[model samples]
Structures are given as structure tokens and as C-alpha cells.
Target: MERDVVCLVDGNKHLYDRGAYLWTLRPSIVNRIRRDYPKARNQDFICFEHLLPYQVEMIQSMMRSDEKQIDKLNRKLTRTMEDQEYRVTDVNETLKETQTFGQKIADRVAEIAGSWGFIIFYIIVLVGWIVINGLHVFGITFDPYPFILLNLFLSCIAALQAPVIMMSQNRAAYRDRMSSENDYHINLKTEEELRILHAKMDHLMQHQFDHNLEIQAMIFEILSEIRITQKK
Candidate 1:
């Protein structure tokens, strides 16, 4: 029996760091992360939690394949990926349908910036005005006369900032949608490869069964020949 292992492949530093932190904490899961965060530099794909089965299989495959053969295979796969029919199908749509996770943080951040954060800031500003008028907060009030002017300013700022904050949320949602699509495509491709593997396995099993049956028939014919010779 062979054990499963995980490896990570990331193009973004922050995402890579996230993966490293998680894998280091629990050295059991091994998966590859593919990310292209423009802001994150110096972070590349990393292999993690190497297990026995994967190592053995890798070694076996490598031993069976020379560099030239491997290159040929890779090229073939790449060409297949570039086929017109495959290209026509939208990969993003498939990824959107299937993803590993939900973009909760993106949603929450957008939500806060759009609504809750504004509400809280507004409350704080209103309190500050009340304190100034009533000489509250240890008698260190700055704007002493109810501060109608400041109140007007705060309201104006809130009105403007609210829309801007809402824009940020909308942007986040777009990014979330894109990320979801990426994850879905990865899964879709994985399942496709699994199907190919399954087909190969089935063919191998059928071939072995047929070979065994042929061997059984051969043995029976040999025994019959022996018996006939003894009867003679």
C-alpha cells in the first residue's frame, strides 16, 4: 500500500505563504496551489508532505522514461490542451461551478467596508459631537457648541464614502468570482484525468482476465492429451 502526498504550486508569494503556514502546522495534507497574485513576489510553487506511494510512483515513472520521452509526452499533452474544441469551452465557467472553497473573507471585507464599518464610524462621529456639546470625556471637549458644522461635514463625508466603500465590495465580488472559476477548472481537469486513468485500469483488468482464461483452457487441453495417450 502507498500513502498519498501533497505538493503546492503557487505563483503568488502571499498565497504560497498561506499554504506553507497551513502545511507546516499539519504535515499530512499535500496539495498544489496555483495562484498569480501580482503583488506577491518571491513565492513560487512548493512541494509538501511527500509520501511513499507518490515517491515510488515518481521514481518508477522517471526510471521508465528518459528525458526525451518525457519531453515528447509533455509536448503532446500541451498540444492537446491547445485544441480548438477544448479552447472553445469556457474554462472559467467550469471553475465557477466547482471550487474548493467560498470567498468568505472577500465577502466580509467588502461588507464591512460598505455597510458596517461606515455605520460604526458614523456612530463614533456622532458621539464625538455629543461629547463636545456636553463637555464629556473628562472635560477635554474640543468642539464646544453642538458642532453643527462638523455634523454637516461628517454627513457629507459619509454619503460620499459610502458609495466608494460599496465599490470596493463590488470589486471584491468580481475577484471572488474569478477565483472560484479557477478552482473549478482545476477540479474539472482533475476529474477528466481520473476518468482517463479509470479507462486504462479497466482495459488492463480485462486483458489480465482474458489471459487467465486462455491459460486455464490451455491447461485443460494438456490434461486431456495426456489422458488420451495413457488410454492408447
Candidate 2:
């Protein structure tokens, strides 16, 4: 079997870009067994059961790293983060998400401005402004006649505000796009790890089955030889 894989993190594993699997084992313990009982030194059993002391130490280091990561993550709110890469990607993703939200709000404002309802509301307000000013009721008419100027003024305000809002939204959209790309990559890696795990499991199981079959065949052969000897 091709044993090609890349990157294993805190019980999470990935095989290229085709699969991912997340699992956990006490590396500190298992690694220790592998190290302290190196198969080469103790050749009485299968190699899988023996371990080197160095291997155990490596597991201890890995455990320490995992613990530190978990502690860091517990203090934050993120999709998947507890390390440098995860943190960088998460920050980028957050920036993107925030930008996306801002753009959506800006889009809503633009839509409201373009709607007939908004226009009608402004018209009514303008009429009331005219009445109040012409009749001098509350004497609060700031801009009297030439309601066209009022329209012009409002238009100018929109012209300036719209671009500013849109500009802000545009910047945010760009950030979001970058973050989404990173997320996609990470997710892709995760998928790859999953596929890799299934493949590994299948291979391991098949190996076990074949091994059992071999043992059974050996037993049968021994029994057959015994019967022949008895018959003789």
C-alpha cells in the first residue's frame, strides 16, 4: 500500500487533498510503549506492540503541544483554531465575515433608496415642510421654497454617502473573499484526511483478515498431517 500522507495535528490527520480524519489517542502512553519496548530489541512478538523510548518522548512532546493549543482555543471564539495557521486563517475569515455583513447592510441601504416607498415618504415629508414654512406654524421651516433645492441637496448627500458606504463594503468583500479561500483550503485538507483514514482502516482490516486466514490454513495443515500419521 502507498503510505503517503501529509500533516497530522492534534488527532486530526490529512492525506494529501483527498481525505481527512479526526481521532485522538493518548500519544503520551502509546508512544511510551512503542519506545520502551522496541521490537528490534525484543523480537519475540509482532513489531506493532513494541516501541522505542524516543518514540515515547516524541509523544510526550506532542501531548504538550496539544495541551497548549487547547488552552489557547478555550480562550477564544473561532470555527477551528488553536495554533498559528488556524489563528491566522480564522482572523482572515473573521475579517471577511465582518466585511460581508457590512456590505449586506450597505446593499440594503441602497435598495431602500431605490425603492418607490422611500421616495414617497420623502415627498410627504417635503410637502409637510412646505406647509409648515408657508403657513409659518411652528416657524421651523429651515429651507423654504425652491423645494427643488431640497431634492438636490438630498441627492448630493446620497451621492456622497452611497459611494462611501459602497467603498467600505467593497473593501470588506475583498477581505471576505480572501478568508473564504483559506477556509476552503483548510476544509479541503480536512476532506482529504477523512478519505485517507477510510483507506487506512480498510487496509488494516484486510491485513488482519488475511493474517487470520493464514493461521487457519496452517492449523488445518497440521491437523491433516496428524491424521495421516495416526492412520499409518
Candidate 3:
């Protein structure tokens, strides 16, 4: 028992239930109708045949907006990756490239001095020196039991070796600091990329849901038209 109304655009009679009132439509659709029919009123009715065009336009607009947002996110991610690329480097290779001849020598000396081979060799030399001097072997009793000359030699070796080892250790600390900074930069960049990806995913999901709802509305409208035709 639905009443009939004239379509605003085509002036054709249609069931009131098969059309939409201007006031109940979305603002975008209302504006589109107003553009075509400048004298259109909030209470005017439009048949589904004319309404379909505006609904399609709205869906296309949403799709375009989603594309623009995705493009913007892609550009942002590219810039972020480019900016972080220069900050990460191999600390070991960089240190090696900048090392001085003296630093190389110091590192070599420290390496040799820290080994068990060096310890054993040093003990053997010391024992040999003591036995040869104390026993006066081969009539070599030049510096008898006190061994002042041997003590001076040991002191000089200690002084030189200490500074060399310290120099190598300082370089090692510098290398560690540079390595830590590089790791931090890499981690920061990864975190930012992940955050941007999450935002992009959320945006896509929200828009996809909106699109699904719009499509579902279109399906319902089509079903209503089919039922109205069958009843006739």
C-alpha cells in the first residue's frame, strides 16, 4: 500500500519506498543532486536510477582518498630509510681505516704480551738469568747476586709495555663506543619503520571497512528494487 512520488530528476512516478528523501541522504549525495537540480529541496524525492550515479561517485572518491593516503605513507617511509642509511657503518672497518702506524704497533704489542706463550718465555728467561749469575756458570760472575743491571732492564720493559697496552685498550674502548652508536641508529630506524607500517595498516583496514559497508548498502538497495518489481 506504498504511495507513489514523482522523481525530482526525471519526473517519473515511482513507489515512495523505492526512492530516498534528500534530507535523509549523505551531504555529498545531496550536494550532487543540488548541482543538477538547483531548485531541489530537503524534502524532495529521487528515484534509485538517478541515486545510483551519486553512490558510485562517493565510492570512487573514497577509493581515491585511500590511494592518496597510501602514497603519502610510502613517501614518508622512503625518506626515513634514506636518512638513516648514512648513519650505520662497520665500526671495525672504519677504525682500521683510520688507524695510525703507532696504534697498529701498540695493538700488536698488547696482543703478544697478553698470551700464555709470552708468560712462559718470560719465566724461562728470568730463571736462566738467575741461575747463570748465581752459579757463575762458564766463569761469568760479572754482576754477582744483586743483579742491578737485570733489575733496570725489567723496569724499562714494564714502563714501555704498560703505556703500549693502555693505548691499545683506549682504542678498543673507542671502537666499542662507535659500535654502540651504530646499533642504536639501526634500532631507531627499524622502530620508526614499524610504527609507520602499523599506521598504514590501520588506515587501510578502516577504509576497507567503510568500502564494505557502502557496497553492502548498494546490495540492499538492489534487493529492495527486485522485491518491488516482483510485487508489481
Best by the TM-score measure: 3
TM-score of each: 0.40, 0.42, 0.86
Scored against the true structure, residue 77 in model 3 reaches a CA lDDT of 88
Alpha carbon lDDT at 29, candidate 1? 21
Candidate 1 per-residue lDDT, tens place, 140-175, comes to 656667676777887897686566566556655766
lDDT (10s digit) by residue, model 2, range 64-125? 65456445444442333333453235655565466656566666776777789989998898
Off by over 4 Å in 2: 1-88, 91-93, 96-124, 134-142, 148-152, 220-232
Rank list by lDDT: 3, 2, 1
- lDDT (Cα, tens digit) per residue for candidate 3, span 4-69: 898999889988877789998888879988998999999999987788788778767777887898
Which scores better on TM-score, 1 or 3?
3
Query: What do the candidate models score in CA lDDT, each in turn?
Result: 0.48, 0.52, 0.87
Deviation in Å, model 2, residue 113 alpha carbon: 7.7
Residue 20 of model 3: what lDDT? 85
